[model samples]
Target chain A: MQGTQQPTPQPTAYPATDRTVPTRSADRASYDKEIVHAILDEACVCHLGFVRDGAPVVLPTLFGRVGERLYVHGSTGSRPLRMTGQADPGLPVCLTVTHVDALILARSGFHHSMNYRSVVVHGTAYDVTDPQEKFLALDALVDQVVAGRSKDSRPANKKELAATAVIRLDLDAVSAKIRTGGVNDEPEDLDLPHWAGVVPLRKGYETPVADPLLAPGTELPDYLRAL
Target chain B: MQGTQQPTPQPTAYPATDRTVPTRSADRASYDKEIVHAILDEACVCHLGFVRDGAPVVLPTLFGRVGERLYVHGSTGSRPLRMTGQADPGLPVCLTVTHVDALILARSGFHHSMNYRSVVVHGTAYDVTDPQEKFLALDALVDQVVAGRSKDSRPANKKELAATAVIRLDLDAVSAKIRTGGVNDEPEDLDLPHWAGVVPLRKGYETPVADPLLAPGTELPDYLRAL
Candidate 1:
């Protein structure tokens, strides 16, 4: 957390906290704001963790980041959403997203690892109740999945909005960890005669399948075509 | 939990628990063992959630599933690893893995969602002690990333094994939730003139890059070449 940057370029690094730091391999942690946002934006789904019955439960859901705030949506009747809606202080939550970019094949099985980028945010999430903001946040969630699709799609009607639940968590406590590059074999194991390197995983968009019941002349829009 | 399968085909389902069931959208939850194993085997990383000081903390880590047992690795000094290793009963943890297959852009913003498959396991994670089992678990982890890379690579030495920690969790209390196919818009909104479809996301492996210091004339193994 001290002087993370070379001091030659980029802005100041993000402030670190007890929860954000990894007990081992502190060098891989980054509190920089840009790094946190970039990783958050790349992944479409996040793991939301909360305490229930003195035990921890993690659920996978979609999320969108706007500025320093992340908005997550769920069924209005869901436990987390319901808790956030009724509580005065909101519900404490830890949201995390990760992407495994490659498999790091080290010469030794002990050193086998993955090239990944992950972000963890610790904060309280409040149920968003303001009608205007809820509408905007819901739009952001859709656009988060496919840009320009929100505008083309119909806005939520009153009945639909009643069934949906949206919660917002400010990104005050956030940290990103990233691992890249080739295998890190030990000095003596370098000549082990085994092939060791990175097998990169790439995420790409495939052909868009139109709905089977689509009205006969509804062409694929330019926005989807661009995807 | 009651007669989940049809008259024929498939395997047994996990017993339902109050914690495992989704309070909302119960129809999307599946305790089918094959579905749970399929989702677990496909993902490389999982979110491990545990209670620390009566609060929730979730960590993203690599995991491999062998039959009904899941093994996760970490540095010996990591917090979760240390906690699991030192305890007699091990740490109570919830592990979850998710795969987002496609973006479901519905005509209405409320119905916009992602087609995803996810699995959650609630159990105690015990520290692996036996050397033979540890070796096999480590090999399973390597093979988890790339199917045949474990046998093709070098086994861990004594010193390497000493520095690594592995935890095993039983899959008795496991559940898989999946949403697939096209958007389910309301009947009235079906002809809204908006483009709605599934934009699939695919994961592909790029050409493997050999380590810069690889010994000369060391041919790329068939295992890695196939990847």
Candidate 2:
């Protein structure tokens, strides 16, 4: 895992060790590293937000976390990448990942909501300029998508790495919020003529489909079997 | 569905109504209504983007779809609501929803990606001012979460509706991109010793749990049972 580093300027009052800082809304916020990592690891897509042309741009991009740091890669000429590189003060960004665990159907429509675990990280993103760090960051990203993947696959060559730019955003000012279980139905609606409960949602992997052009007798890896 | 309407300005060259949209790069850009609706309907949360104090703010919020319009409701005092109402020419906004279908694990790290369906709508959102339309819009939002739910549940009181503000963003500049099925392994990696394929993701519902305070003899609704 690359790009994972401890936070700088640990607060004297809070003195957080990792990406754990309690929010004003203590009920909905979690500072536990395990809770934060679990939510990020389970989510496959991340909504990356950055300012572009004085307006907010939120794009769905694939991301992977390496401990305390998050890595997002994009084309070298992409709008946000260019903006980040040009901004004198660095580009402010909010990267978020959410997993929908279930849909809560309540007796009352007003109370209907989804059971979700989401992490919202607010900070400044700077372009990773160091070649050695960039290469490791890209590999961390690939491994994030599929665990133990970077080692098993070929690393990016110099030309390929040059073509892709990785942006590093430290995991500071981060907060994770989760809502789970059944709906919080009003007492009166409990007796109402409606079904009330949660519909669970899950993500599963299917049997591996070797590429059509795959050479015969190439065995499946243990990682794919575990999934 | 209240906010599901495709915006009025039609793209001159619409893709054929048939389902043969290619799975690769071509279909990555689609203005099809079916594709847009399917992606939006299946998703429970949307990334709402707006400009605040000249800086971009992107937040994940609940949304619902009507015939041609997408309805998003929030606290009347929220920044997005205030920005849209106060701006001289309204706020430029982007609302996106994505459903991750699978994780594609390729033999090469560079090729690993996700199979997902996503919709991005670019437009200027306006506040819903008309009282009658506001009521209907609120109903549409409720129904969007659960079909036939509005009729079965109680409607919002005048005060509650007044406290909530609903913004309408037409699907005029809407586009949906979907990537499905297995990984696109590099030909050179065909003989590589790694498993390569996709793990399918599914969302399902569990049996209803009656509210803890449910009165005796409350019957479950058929709609929930069907789910």
Index of the highest-DockQ prediction: 1
> Candidate 1, after superposition: displacement of residue A215 in Å?
3.5
> Which residue runs does candidate 1 get wrong by more than 4 Å?
A1-13, B1-11
The 0-to-1 C-alpha lDDT of every candidate, in the order given, reads 0.86, 0.73
Of all native A–B interface contacts, model 1 reproduces a fraction of 0.85
- List of clashing residue pairs for candidate 1: none
Q: What would the per-residue lDDT of candidate 1 be over residues B1-227, giving only the tens digit for each residue?
A: 47867676634899989888989878999999988988888877899998777777788998887888999988899988888864477888899999989999888888888898999999899999999989888988888887877887889889879989999999988889989889798888888898788889986788888889987877888877775
- In CAPRI terms, model 1 is classed as medium
- Write the residue-wise lDDT of candidate 1 on A1-227 in tens digits: 58766655744566698888878778989998988988988776899999877778899988988888999998898988988874468888999999889988888887788888999898889999999988888888888887777898999889878888999999887788988888899888898888888888877789998887776788999888887
State how far residue B40 of model 2 sits from its true place (Å): 1.0
Listed for each candidate, the true contacts retained, as a fraction, are 0.85, 0.56
Candidate 1, residue A188: lDDT: 88
| Model 1 Cα shift for residue A8 (angstroms) | 23
Candidate 2 Cα errors over 4 Å, as ranges: A1-26, A86-89, B1-27, B86-89
